[model samples]
Target: MSELHDEVLRLSGVGKTYNPGTPLAQNVLQDIDLRLARGELCALIGPSGSGKSTLLNLIGLLDSPSAGELYLQGRPTRALDDAARTRLRNRAIGFVFQFHHLIPAFSVLDNVLMPLMIRHGKPDAEDRARALELLAAVGLADFAAKKANQISGGQQQRVAIARALVTRPALLLADEPTGNLDTRTAESVFALFRRFNREFGCAVLVVTHDPRLAAQCARTVELVDGRIVRDAANTAAK
Candidate 1:
């Protein structure tokens, strides 16, 4: 494992409260402090209602923290405006959700190129080449011409991983990315995450419930009742 000093994502005393100032107000996370270093593969695991997703959202820059500060690439993000946050997120973060969220109408290649297209108008040959390279990396080069919906669940998730990598993000966040797959398939997908983290030197934070899956990561952070309970090295079981 790398030193914590080389952190990519850092959360200090972070907290989140929803619907503040109303009867529905509820605190979802409390005093969360964590750090993810480049090339690190960490697992965020907790039971239902443990605020794992909330914490992930906060770190991914998709939601703001109610307290404390979050640093991405060593820059404090508490004061960044929406446009600044969006630009920072686009340049530094990649996300994969439980659902692949690929457009069924678009071809797999186009789906992988979505991020690049959003940043710049049309995809040039270089962009297309990178998209194809990612597809090949995910073992889906042949599926590039097919519509997203034509692929299997596992294949679609692979495409999502490729799409996430298209941006060459420094931090990759995945929430239950393998939740819908069979055990074997899930292992395969998880392996791909490990491969990419090593090859691209990106920090990965994945939320999962399976102990076996969590065990595969280099570090694991456990949350319960909106608070961090444990953070430790995996120490792979013999």
Candidate 2:
């Protein structure tokens, strides 16, 4: 297949400035040109003040860029209306945050089904089955009936991963998904990302501060002072 056919995301001259016309204006990201192909797993690394999260937000369509355009699955995003953006985001993108953000009131199974529920009112039998299967994949099959608040922090994060994957999005954007866990737990959580990236063929862009974790990805993109300074394939990736 051609590059266009395999392209899941592209950003062309993209920039984000918080308050463009005032003294308080701050440029969070600049000239971010990037492309993620189908099933590719890449890591975004940067210092504390860098624009890593800002870039992820733009790619995830949670925020609009201040300049240039973004394309998701070859469709331009700058011209999309609010409803259209929501529809496209739901259909093509999945997000996993450091906080997991599971609903404490819902059961684990219901939590995984939230994305499907939000997209189409109530979920059907197939949706429920898919959620269960994902839970099983994450080793949470036995905890499906438990409330979200009842699970350990690591388990809650697993639920978040399953929830993100329930919609089978073409691209998965993770913003510091392992930032809160212990070393062992973090590796386990990240392993799930790799596993799903391989099995489901979803393009993954994960923001991480850990060099060890970044080294595990096939490609690494480094950011500094709101600009990408390095984007190269890892020769020793495992």
Candidate 3:
């Protein structure tokens, strides 16, 4: 396959500006050019207010870019309508946020099955099997029947990861996934991302402020003042 065909994501001169036509308009991202191939593990690092969150939001299809095109799984997203964007995002991208966001009332297994249930009302036997498999992979099989709120924060985050992967998305976008965890817990959560990337061949892009966690990614992209200042491979990735 051609290089383009191998890429799971591509941003061509992508830019984002809030309140675009007003004097109060603030440009959050500019001339952002990037690409991630299948199974590539990359870390996005930048100082606060450097636009990392905005960039991830755009890439995750939560918002549209104002000045350029973004292609996800080779499909151009600039002109896609809201419904189309939603559909594509659900099918091609998975997300893990700083907060696990699992419903407190739901069982751990139910949380993992949420995505599938959203895509197709009421998960079937196969869906349950997949959820159980993911829970086991994350070492949470024993907690499957417990309420999400009953688990520890780190365990909840693992449940979130399992939920994100249930769809088998082509790209996984994780925004500060381990920001609230302790050092040891953080490392374990980060490892789950690497494991899933290798096993599932999904392109992984994680935004993290932790240098230790960032160093583990194979590639790193640094953003500053709304533009990428550096994007390079880590020679000593763990």
TM-score, each model?
0.96, 0.98, 0.98
lDDT (10s digit) by residue, model 2, range 99-150:
9999999999999999998999999999999999999999999999999999
Give the whole-model CA lDDT for all candidates, comma-separated: 0.93, 0.94, 0.96
Candidates, ranked, TM-score: 3, 2, 1
RMSD of each: 1.5, 1.1, 1.1
Clashing pairs in 2: none
For residues 1-238, what per-residue lDDT tens digits would candidate 3 score against the true structure? 2287879999999999999899999999999999999989999999999999999999999999999899998899999999999889999999999999999999999999998988989999999999999999999999999999998999999999999999999999999999999999999999999999999999999999999899999999999999999999999996
Give stretches of model 3 more than 4 Å off: none
Model 2 RMSD, rounded to 1 decimal: 1.1
lDDT of 1 by residue, 1-238 (tens): 4566678988999999999999999999999989889988999999999999889888989889999999998899988999999999999999998899999999999999999998887999999999999999999999999999999999999999999999999999999999999999999999999999999999999999989989999999999999989999988822
Which prediction has the highest lDDT against the true structure? 3
Q: Quick one: ranking by lDDT, best first?
A: 3, 2, 1
Candidate 3 collision pairs = none
